[model samples]
Target: MGWMRRAKVARDDPDSTGATNTVNEHQINNEGQRSNINSLPNELLLLVFYDAIQSHDNCSAVLAVTCRRWRNIVIHEPKFWGSILLGSCHPLGKYRLWTMRIGTHSPPRRISLIIRGGPSVYIEPEWIQLFDALKARTYTIQSFHFHGNSESLSWANLRMGGFLCEEIYLHLDDRLSMNSSISAALSEPTWPTPYPPPLENSISPKILSFRQA
Candidate 1:
């Protein structure tokens, strides 16, 4: 009877040891997983978040509200705030404000205005005002392109100070209709002429070209 009891006790001991070992292994795995998750560098994490936000439009506001860390990165990302694509229904004042914000925040290296929705959608007068402001700080702008109707060129008469623009591309919908007006505007010797005054000695004229298309 005593020998049987000893054998039974030994069996129970091995079973309890096996159960304890299994529990320990599971705990170790759980701890390792947590450590791995926390090991990612902050910059890598930020990049992951940025990739999520950049894949969509109109999600910037939501991205900004995600968290303090995300907000900091999103606000400072130059690509996030560089260009403002004006929509036909966008309010003139709102467009002006957004342009100013982008100029102040990131100061884009290029300004591209696409006016191709239709001829009826004219560049607003407030856009002219924004351009005037941008011209004053023209040292930051490297290239400017206008693709749309000639009616939008009316504001080109505004004078501009010293600017080192490498290129200026003007695409006129009706070149003949706007030729005389554009020529007159360009010829103006006034201080604030229609275009940012040519960056004479700053950039080579050879670097400049005009395309009618």
Candidate 2:
């Protein structure tokens, strides 16, 4: 009887010990996961946040409000504010914020405004307002590329004031196809005078295209 009882005790001991070991292993794994999450650097975290924001505007705005650190990083990042690629669904308000948020650094060197899909109603006044605002700034904007329905093109605004742009490319739908529109807009008579010719011997054009966009 003594030997039989000892055998039963030995068998129960292994089962109890195995259960404890399993619990311990689980706890260790949880702790390790927490530690790895905490170890990620702030820069890495910021990049993760940027990726999250790029896909959806609502998410971006929400993330921007997550904390002061996130807000500051997103606001100061030049890429966030410099150039905006617009699609057919125009979010004018967002564009306004994007433009306003740009750093004091001169306007972006390249501006690509693409409007795709079938033609939409063209509201001349809003386009005029936006173009006028662009003209009012003193900074030299190098290029403006537009792609979309020709009728939607705001020719009046594009032709307004002096745009310090070196190269302007307009790709339009078949309806308003006219290469002359590009020339006419660039040839506005009242265009602002370009900055004084570079000192008698400047090697670069007042504005040069460093890269093709």
Candidate 3:
């Protein structure tokens, strides 16, 4: 009878062990929620950061400066630095930094660079700098897009030295047809061989030409 009464008390009293267990469980859950972000597993952290980056192209640069951990992640990961677009809006000061970051990849990954130019675009120097800076990286240029004036025709030839690019897009102004030297260069056996520039606009043609090698 005594043993039976003791068992009944234990079962019926919720304040004895049940309440303590519930409180402990709640505390455990709260601690988990308050855990430090840096305490997260490296793999999971990488996935979270990569998701942010893939969602927005510029997020790669943004996330790199958030904290030391994220910066390290961006620096070590080659995929983040694989593609570079130097448009008219991008600041020229950051170009060297961007190229250097991409240069860190071993056997360097395939890269795509788009250089936006206009009539007075002085991108020949930019191209020379990029080519020189990336030489040691041994980077493989997959595609290069240039948009600028006819004056660049002669100077831009420097970009073709060691470029094993798969595709090249040159959006040069129509004056290229008038200059005999530029016209002759474009007619060479290896130059614009397969892809011919469109002749739609005769006066000041904006030639959106492409060559696949």
The TM-score measured for candidate 2 stands at 0.44
The numbered model that scores best in TM-score is 2
Cα RMSD (angstroms) for every candidate in the order listed: 17.1, 15.1, 16.7
Give the alpha-carbon lDDT of every model: 0.51, 0.51, 0.52
- Across 42-119, the per-residue lDDT of candidate 2 in tens digits comes to 788667866765554345445567667667777776555444555444445555766667756554455556554432
**Worst lDDT window (10 residues) for model 2?**
204-213
How would you encode candidate 1's per-residue C-alpha lDDT over 1-213 as one tens digit per residue? 654555556567876665555556766897898577447776776667557544533344455676676567666665665434343444345445445545555544455555555434434565545556666653455555556655454434233334445445566665554333332223322322233445465542122334344
TM-scores of all predicted structures: 0.41, 0.44, 0.44
Off by over 4 Å in 2: 1-40, 44-71, 87-91, 116-121, 151-159, 175-213
55 Cα displacement, candidate 1 (Å): 12
TM-score of 1: 0.41
Winner by TM-score between candidate 3 and candidate 1: 3
Clash totals, every prediction: 6, 1, 0
